[model samples]
Target: MENSINVSSEVGTLKRLLIHSPDSGLGKVVPSKAQDWLFEDIVHLDTMRRHEYDYYVKTLLYFLDTEKIKGKLNEIDGDESRNFYKPDHPDYFNSEKVIELQKLLADILEDNLTKMKLIAAICAIEHEWYTTHDELLSLSPNELAKTLISGTTPGNEMLFPPIPNFIFTRDIGITINNHLLLNKPAKLARTREALLSQYIFYNHPMFAEIRKNLIEIPDNETLFLLPEEEAESNQSTLEGGDVMMVAKNHLLIGISERTSIYAAKQVIKVLFEKKVLDKITLIKIPKKRDYMHIDTVFTQVKRNMWVILGTLAKPHSESEDEVLIRSGLLKSKKSEKVHLVQFRRGQENEPRVIESLEELLTEISVYDLNCSPLEVQFIYSGNNEFPFGAREQWTDSCNLLAIKEGVVIGYDRNDKTLEAFKEAGFEAVKVADLLQDFEAGRRSPETIQNTFILLPSAELSRARGGSHCMSMPIFRENFE
Candidate 1:
């Protein structure tokens, strides 16, 4: 059956989301090879995976050492075919007895490769049967849960590189107004991320039917599948972080460091062709790591409010209206204008000009957003302080995740941004504080609006992402 997906606005109540809690994949990263695997720093995975394993082991012990097992052992002892079995017989050495033991272990072990090894050991000792890897994966969810969260290796070699960047799930794919656009990350570090989303949407039972009506877009790698001449200079790539829905039918995508114009053009073509979007506005920002995605600099906090990097909110051009009129290139009813400019990069040999949105208007306004109904007000990061804005932007001050209209989640460390929100009629609160109040029945989420729920960021901040970058909402309740 096809599952219905309705995500029309960023602040809609999230009903379903996909998250990969940290797993054994962390062990695949090492200091010497971190960069190769896309990790900037090494995490203590052995402890983390061991904790998961230990929990699984407890579940195994509880399930295996049951009254049924005792009864079965007694039955084996009572049976007297040609040879009699004894209660004291070596249970580990007996094939029938060991089969139950192996099943118990396999059911709770979380790492697939390690589970396979357990299967191999059982077969080798029993000399009874050999199980294939596919057969192991086909086990029940009770069995697969133990194995899917971690990675496994044989001896000293790393079989699967840990997906550290998986925490920032927003970069893997984008959920358009109604369709899902799976992104092809520009770097190899994130290819598996794309594959994971693809697998879930295609194979996972929850999304099986949705595939029928939902339009599927390509990863940048799809370009390589085309002829060389067709693929040349077509290094298109899009990350979910760069794509956003500012209104019911209006969208804004950034052609920034992480997203390329080539990729944007391809995505825009698909959106228009499918009629999935009415007005799509593409913005071009300076290609810098700190501002890798547009969300890093701009995102809707509510229907009429937005939080923006101070640099972008401030007019770089002489006049915001003039820039829009000169650079704005609006299409007919179905299309909008984007500006593109040509410039030189660091070296004369490098071309560094941005292609305009109507193809490069450097302003954020009603015309720029292409949504006149939106009377957007700004909440500047660092409260418009130069040094503070620069610092907080690096730490993702502008990237906030809206849970409901006027209520959002962000990093607690960005105090200035929080103050800016408060100044603009938003109430400030911490996640921990909110949880305590909710548990006490003191308040409900529905009653909260324009509230900023700040998350602790000791380690999360190190990932260089904010709350918006950490989640990929698959479904949201329709508000209209």
Candidate 2:
């Protein structure tokens, strides 16, 4: 049951897609301290999950013979009741709940440590669960360094950190011409999602099947980005939330709140090693408190085209600490690394740098592409002051869901963003009222490309990731 989206085509039908239906995992959040819990607002987890299921999962399930939870591990690895170990995991055996969870997994999996890695896998799933009052109080210097990466202990006064808002299979990993460059999240809060994605991609039968293409390639043929490059992070530094898959061969990397220019560079290097993308176009999303991903700006509209929220149409300006480029690398948005790269290794590759959203679109031939076969478009975001207009742009209005070909679903908050679609002669459907932005994160394309997991849990709503940001489509309908 492997799924794929055909690239190099004009506009492919979304023949099959992956979706994560929300679940009880969200009930873990404490609403009163929503923001502290990585949530912008509050919603009933049970009802919210149900709502997303209807909007994303059930709506498209019949359209696809979606792959359910991978039963391969259940039969072999036993994630629920299996007991695994990670001697170097740093946090294993730290919490009572984790210990209990381990036992539960062991009972369910019934495998020896050598055979099972369930404990580590579950810890990887529970990103915030590792941060506890006890764990925080007793941080050694090493753990302290890791905690500092997360900035500071949140003021939520809760037992566990919030799970990832969503790990839509589509967002975290995808087929880079067959081999999947599964992203290892730069942010610890979202690390669990990466772990889950890793599990789904590697342990699951379908993704595992496709992996052969990756390993079978020639050794010097190209390795994609090395995993070591992805290891660099500032802790609370960034998440996959900000990344955007634009052209079939390019990645639109946004250096904003959660994602840094340096981190993006590192990620790109990994992709290059794997031959994932031909190049990565770095886009500077406004570093506001609200908008976390580039997805808050745009997504696929029709075949060979995109529907972008207008705010990102502007260009980049020098930040306070910015410095002049020195040839090898240029000034980064926030981190110490250079934003424009001459020879950086990872996420930073080819910098088709631009200052404004309009410039970026022009460089990508977005206007011309839209007119021809692609039909790419752009619309303004927010009322008057978009990120380009306003000092702050977060509601994630830019993230959109491409329904049928050029047809799309998106947030209503920034109605202006829809102008691009209209201008391009594409139909845009407003889903604000009926399709709530269940998670504070508004990025669409969250669902898995061709599965039926439903939004992993209440976390998607809590983390503010929309369907787009949550998913990473391995396969898509070819639209040549």
Candidate 3:
């Protein structure tokens, strides 16, 4: 099968994606190191997998590759070892459409040269394990792949810290119209992820044809000569969460906590030079952990609809006293402000400034999507209600993944958000129920429209990511 890559829009019919299931590494997250691994709290790995993420896999299979999962649901569920989900196992459902990151890693490691290089590279970073290089090389490709990701041997001996955040595969790389832009993670904990991703995209046979199109943001060479504080400000760091290929000719890059302005600048320059995109919008959001990435604050539900955090949605009218205070701007909080700037390919100097998030999204809908102003819609987090808005946003109510236009997957715990969806004339259904309906021929992925498929999120929410952050759509059916 050819590994064709093209993602023009977020809400396009998702045909292929990269996902990593919750592995033993997730179970290894200790309370003290939970935050270090980018998790809000340690989750019950079994519950997160069987109850939450397993449904995600099944849903994707049903939509993208029905033959792999349609009639075999019973046999898959009956397996106590869950070998079907394990990439290394013979019984694994290795669907090309619903690809697994670990499976790809294992595939690449099958070559002795690649395996040796990866093991050496990883051992070099994890200095303590440098002596075990020979031991790792002796292991099979599958074992080595698992050991590299989970940082444990077959006997469960810890060689290094597990990459618990690996479950969020969207951060590894992003596909933008036949091109793959690799990520440069901001956190030290995600260093291994970046390295592993680099190797996978560059060496994996599946991505061989598009290797030339793989864009890696170059670092600002002069930063080293500057003072520590100055260098920090100009550092080039970008994660996949900050980048979105919203339209065929337009891309959105967020300057947030995980993505740097310098990196965004690099992207604009490279992309324009290569003519990958004609317009690039740089959205600078508050550099707070609460909104780590722009996707965490908002995501497209359809060509004409979006779900955004209410606080950042629309600008409020100011009183005469407030207007006067704004002249001095002494009391205004910088952290709460959002700034948007759009740069066209030729007119880079005279970039257009957007006033608010709503205006920018509205423009995309109206201009790019060819939607009328009256047709556009905005659904606020927690139905825009106070306390609930902030509470639900914290749990990623805005971060939803659209399997198709108007059909999104979100957390079931966000009741207020579901109510908002219902108010907007969307049917809300649980994933478990949806799967059963699919099996019974009562409903199908194609038949579902204007719906919210809610996943069990008791443990998944603790990871601070929704279905959007968990998925990296490599291919989507063109909206046009």
- The prediction achieving the highest lDDT against the true structure is 3
Record all residue pairs in model 3 with backbone atoms less than 3 Å apart, i.e. clashing. none
| lDDT tens readout by residue for model 3, 140-198 | 88898899999988889888788988888888988999999999899989999789889
TM-score of 1: 0.67
The superposed Cα distance between candidate 2 and the true structure at residue 316, in angstroms, equals 8.0
* TM-score rank order: 3, 1, 2
Report how far off residue 156 is in candidate 2 (Å).
Answer: 22
Model 1 clash count equals 30
Kindly list the per-residue Cα lDDT of model 1 for residues 1-480, writing each as its tens digit.
024465777766655454444444665567897766655567665433232222211111212222223224334334433121111124422222112211223333545555455445433432433443455445553444323323342223233455577767787766776677878677776765565455455544455556764444554667768888876446777788888765556566777767778877777667767777665666777766667787788676765567877656543453544544566521222222233333221222333344433112232234333434445577888998857987888788888877667777777788888789888888887665565464455766557677887766655565677778866766666655
TM-score of each: 0.67, 0.59, 0.96
- Report every candidate's CA lDDT: 0.57, 0.43, 0.89
Candidate 2 residue spans exceeding 4 A from truth:
1-11, 62-115, 120-164, 167-171, 212-238, 303-306, 309-311, 316-352, 365-376, 382-393, 412-463
Indicate the residue-level lDDT of 202 in model 1: 56
Q: Count the backbone clashes (under 3 Å) in each candidate.
A: 30, 92, 0
Report the error of model 3 at residue 304, Å.
0.4
Taking all chains together, the TM-score of candidate 3 against the true structure is: 0.96
